[model samples]
Target: MASVRVEALTKRFGDRQVVNKVSFQVADGAFAVMLGPSGSGKTTLLRCIAGLELPDSGSVYIGDVLMDELSPRERDLSMVFQNYSLFPHMSVKANLAFPLVVRHRPRGEVEERVRRTAELLRIEQHLDKRPNQLSGGEQQRVSLGRAIIREPRAFLMDEPLSGLDAPLKLQMRAELKRVQRETKLTTIYVTHDQVEGMGLASVLGVMNEGELIQYDAPAEVYARPRNAFVAGFVGNPPASLLEAEVREENGNLELRGDGFTYRVGEDLARALKGNTDRVIIGVKPEGVKLVRAQRAPNDIDGVLDYTEDFGSTVIAHLRIGQGSISASIPPQEGIGLEAGARVGVRWDAEKLSFFDARSSERIV
Candidate 1:
């Protein structure tokens, strides 16, 4: 296993900068996930690292060796594509052995690796079956086995589990994490699914437009988002954003918006150095609370819109002052708040995220 480093990598197609000066390092044996929406340049960045797409102006280093001029074959990287690119003409065993065979590995070594890879991916029972004969999940596992059997320097996976059903996605996420840890493979995976990325990544990167926005541990990216985009994009259901103006009313900081005023703590107030007048306030579902109250100094009034119950937790959707937001309500508080019933919304000050209204940068 070896670290994979990409230095100031950028790629463009004609006029559009698809991937813009991105730089990051994956430590040896680390599971790093690049997360973003489509057209955010995650796949382009991955392709650059894999030698599939040449970066306009940057370098890719596998271990200590520069690989800018190297071909895909010369790079010795295993890439598991989204489509499960397995050969229908070949059996699972043949597919797993293909990589080694192409490299002119000994027959004995090829057979041994095929068997072990099949076992590792739990596709041993399907060894004699062609890809078309197997289920989607089975074929995907075989596809992964083919990649794993190569034992390359690093594994680059582009949404390999996206085709699976919801339950299978859950199962494969566990399996993929286990395989990476058991083999200690340095892996980089790309996905648009925040839940999937959060589950599999030791290091999570959030990207937007053509730029890498924030790179950090998944927890840090969620709890301490570097900007509004990171805060809105990282969490499941994400953070709810609201427009407001910052003010120092009577020597105490406050966030005033439609029909309500929110007090800001001293710690958070100090984080704002200058230009603190206009700001956007963000609160996670878990931070916003549902209170049965008449409009108060800091309580925003709203009407219960709807709810989403997932057995373990309940999300209360409320309409507040021309805008709507969702809050994670305890089972006890979830009841009796039906649609059209007026309610009060309050936030935990420490949990609120304040961003500059103009730049959308985090202030606290």
Candidate 2:
């Protein structure tokens, strides 16, 4: 397995900059996932790394070699695309053996590698069937089998599980992780699904507007986001962002806004003292609590908007001022709170995140 690296990679189309000076490295034998919304240039970046797209600037490196002039075949990287891309007329065994066959490997060696690859992907039962005869999951496995048969230096997958049904996607996710671990393959996967990124990757890179926003372990990105966009983008329900202004009141830093005035402790005050006066108040769904009265400290009055039951938990949507907040509570705890009901919303002070309003970067 080989490490993959990109340095200040930039790509442009006509007048629009699609990938803007992006840079990151995937360690050897590491499972790295590039996650972002559509048109964020993740797939384009993967193509650049695969030598399929020439960058306008910057460099691509596999292991220790510069790969700018190398063709896709010369790079020795295998790509599993979203569409499966298996030959409809060819049987699974033939498809898996095609790479070695084209390279003029001995027929006996090709058969042996194909057999091993089929067993590794657990698709041995489907080896005699063509792509059209297989289930979606079976075809996905066959696609992976073709890549694994070549024993390439690294693997690139572009939303490989997106086409599968929800349950199949869940099943294939575990299957892919198991196959990767067994082979110890260095892999780069691109997807917009946060669940897939969190589930499969040893390292995760978040992108927005063609820029690499944050790259870290999935848990770290969730717990400590770099800015407001990341804070709002990485979580399930995401952190609620509300506008507020920092005001000095009797040696204290107070966040004052429509229908709310929150005071920060001395330690945070010292940190925000010289910074900007405006900030975006952020609260996670789990940090929110609903109350019948304004008895709790820091409680902000709000109107219940709706509730969603999830068996284990209920998410209560509340409207406080013009901003919305999602509070995760036990079903029993969320009982009686329905739309149009007035409730007091309180956020855990310790878990709150603050971002500069203008820069949208984390202040504390």
Candidate number achieving the greatest TM-score relative to the actual structure: 1
- lDDT of candidate model 2 versus the reference: 0.89
Residue pairs of candidate 2 with colliding backbone atoms: none
lDDT of each: 0.88, 0.89
Pairs of colliding residues, candidate 1 = none
Query: Candidate 1 lDDT, tens digit per residue, 1-364?
Result: 7999999999999989999999999999999999999989999999999999978999999998999999998888999989988888998888889989988999988988888888889988989988999888888888888898989999999999999999989988999999999999999999999999999999999999889998999999999888888888877688888888888889888778765677877787777635678888888889988778555577888888998887778888888777677899878788777889988888888788888989999877
Weakest 10 consecutive residues of candidate 1 by summed lDDT = 266-275
Q: How much is 18 displaced in model 2, in angstroms?
A: 1.0
